[model samples]
Target: MRQDKPELRNLSEPVRFKRALALLLMTLVLPGSAQIVAGSKKAGRYAWRVIAGLVAIVVFLVLLSLVWRSGTINLIVSPTTLRIVQVLLILLAVGWAALFVDAYRLGRPLTLERNHRLTASILDGVLVVLVMTVLIWSSTIVSAQRDFVASVFGNGEKSKADKGRYNVLLLGGDSGANRIGVRPDSLTLASIDAETGRTVLIGLPRNMAKVPFPAGTEMAKQFPNGFEWDGCGHDCYLNGVYTWAMGHKQHFPGVKEPGLVATQQAVEGLTGLKVNYYVLIDIAGFQHLLDAVGGITVDVGKKVPIGGIGGPIKGYIKPGKDQHLDGYHAMWFARSRAGASDYERMTRQKCVMTAMLNQLSPQKVLTKFQGIASASKEVVQTNIPSGELGTFTDLALDSKKLPVSSFSPVPPLIKTGDPDFELIRAKVAEAVGKSEALDKGSDDGDGKKSGTPSSVSPTKKPSTPGKTPSKPSTDVDDVAQVCKA
Candidate 1:
């Protein structure tokens, strides 16, 4: 009888192995399922309830987003909510890992044959890793959001859109150790239509001086005529406004970011457009961000010198049809002003922006998510509130489908040393009007006239009465065509 019992138990080894595999698979598919079927029913029930509750909460949030978009955004961006969620995610990860290990123990993996026991252990390890990985990732994202909101947003008064348009000031500059202070070398105002997402990039020269400030502001009072007030020297250029303001921060009482505030006021006064927000990009950090995204492809129309002007000359980005540039080269490509004019550099910068917008596809972003996120945090500093991110994200998606046009208030258009503010305003209005007209024509489906406005192309030449002349090219260009690699 004893010999028969030993044989029976040995014969059931295969059955035990099959049961263990089944429980592991069940746990993988549905947390706590395996324990309920073969392990501690109490522990399994608790875990299952938690899992179901989480799913329900997620569904609720989704429904809330659909019903109340703004409210949902505000709730999600709330700092308190983010911290709580982060803690919850960490707890969930620990709990899920424990449940996975408990499930393996409940399977009685130790009782199985040596091979089966090893297999079970490996499976259990994989399950724990996957579960913990997901939870940890979620926690990380929540923490990032919290940091982003805290760092970039302000409690100050928010500006409203004017005439259904939001004009955002995008400043690209350097704060290198070799440099003085924050000099906004590249200044552009992105004027976006609220309804259609139609956008126009208005580029201003860094050497532009005699910049005016909005009336009634402290800066305006000081520089009523222009920024060329007494005590200001050759450094009174538009780019130096930030540095000047920072040096005299006490002049602008109660202003937290005096330099940015002063710059925003100047932009508004210069373009005759209400500047809602400003985004400052550190040139060095910008290069890091480009590298994080695996570099970008651009069409280099000319040989651009790299590293010059006091610093040792590095090299040159040779002219090419489709040039792939790493961060260092791309930075120099957009910033190099040795042989090329700042206006030309502005065009190249726009091309870089367009290339990134078109080429950095969703798949690439996912693959380089962590690196991109880390670099972006270091690179971008904006006053745009986190609560408004969702709205802007949607707008960005809409803008992607539309054509991007640019206008440079340089040279023939407007003198940099002493700009005609009235003419500058008129030119800005004209450019915006042309963009709006094009959008309207497209919406109305006027096939013959639906194309981009001829006047918007800076390259277009005036047609003669007797014959049609070749269109002259201007600084303004179709971003897509210009960015083609």
Candidate 2:
């Protein structure tokens, strides 16, 4: 009987160790399961209830998203909701970690063998780390979304598309401390077809003078003869509209973004397209954004200088077919005007945009989401509402498959200094018509001839004066091809 008793004790030690290990694993899988099996019933019940509530909330959010995606996105992106979610994630991490520790305790780990006890400690450490990592990651994403919402979106009435196309004016400028005010050095109108996602990039020159405003508007009333008013002699240029309007803010009563508003009006009047929204990007901040996305690759057509106008010359980006550019180098590549004209700089900027659109793949975006989100908030400002973001996102994805075409009103096409509005409208109409036909041809599966222009070649230099501009040399053969190289 004495020998049997010792044997039974030995057997019971192994059984206890196995039970403890089982309970710890169960708790790891289902937060309250181990507690219910071995620990206090009351604690297990509370944890189960909390888990159930979280699951219910998630299910409800999913359903809501399916029914009304825009509303759900707006609610999620709201600053208040982001803060609440961040706090909840932190609380969840703490609560989950505590439950894990309790699960280890319920297993009676202290009574196990030395090896078993060490194993339990290791398991406990892993559980805490894994749970906390997920919660913290979610919290960081929420914070980034909040900052993006607050910095980028502005309180502006959303405008409807005109003739099945949404025209968005994109402005890029240097907002450095040395600059007097925001002077939009580069302006491009991204006119996207609502259904087909066909895009036409319309580039406008910065030094273009005599810019007209939409008739019957306050700006038109102020400058009936164009942006060149009585006092504004040489300062009345297309890019100067923003700074000029800002200086005369009293003229635009009850307007929040008078500068952008004025610029939009000017672009709309020039392009003969109704402008729906505007996105302003600070050139300096754009560098940081590029760095966040691991930089971008572009085809450098010519030798571009780096930092010469204001500061000393830093370096030069040598001409190459496929050049990978970091943030600093990329900024100079887009903005440098040392030996190049503004027209050439405009083309380079368009190339940069094309590269970004094509090269910023989904994998890169997901991996570098945090950095990208934070940098975007600093560099970008727009009146695009949070509610419409999903729709635009879908359109942007659709556009990737379609070819992008560009039209610039520079020399050999349309004179920028004294542009003929009628001629500009005709060119815009022709470009849009060709894009629509191409998209239609693609949809019809006509592989032989998809309405794509043979004259469009990215490598062709602009035709000199006296030559017929029937097919200007400064046309994009395939924006995708240029970007991919």
Best by TM-score: 1
User: For each predicted model, how many residue pairs clash, with residues at least 3 apart or on different chains?
Assistant: 7, 1
Model 2, 1-485: lDDT tens digits are: 11323433465667877776777678778888887876678888998998999899889888997876556666766678889999999998898888888887766676678998888788888989999999999888888877777777755577787877888899997888988777899899998987767788887888888888899877898888888866775589999999988888998998876889999989988878899988899998899999999888877766788988767888899876668999989888888988778877877787788778778886887678889888988888889886567556656777877777787777776677787877877677666656666555534354312233423323323333222122222343345444343
Candidate 1 per-residue lDDT, tens place, 86-113, comes to: 9999998898788778777766676799
Compared with the true structure, all predictions reach lDDT values of 0.76, 0.77
The RMSD of every model to the true structure, in order and in angstroms, is 5.6, 5.8
Clashing pairs in 1: 458-473, 458-474, 459-472, 459-473, 459-474, 460-472, 461-472
Q: How close to the true structure is residue 351 of candidate 2, measured as C-alpha lDDT? A: 75
How many angstroms is residue 335 displaced in model 1 relative to the true structure, after the best TM-score fit? Answer: 1.0
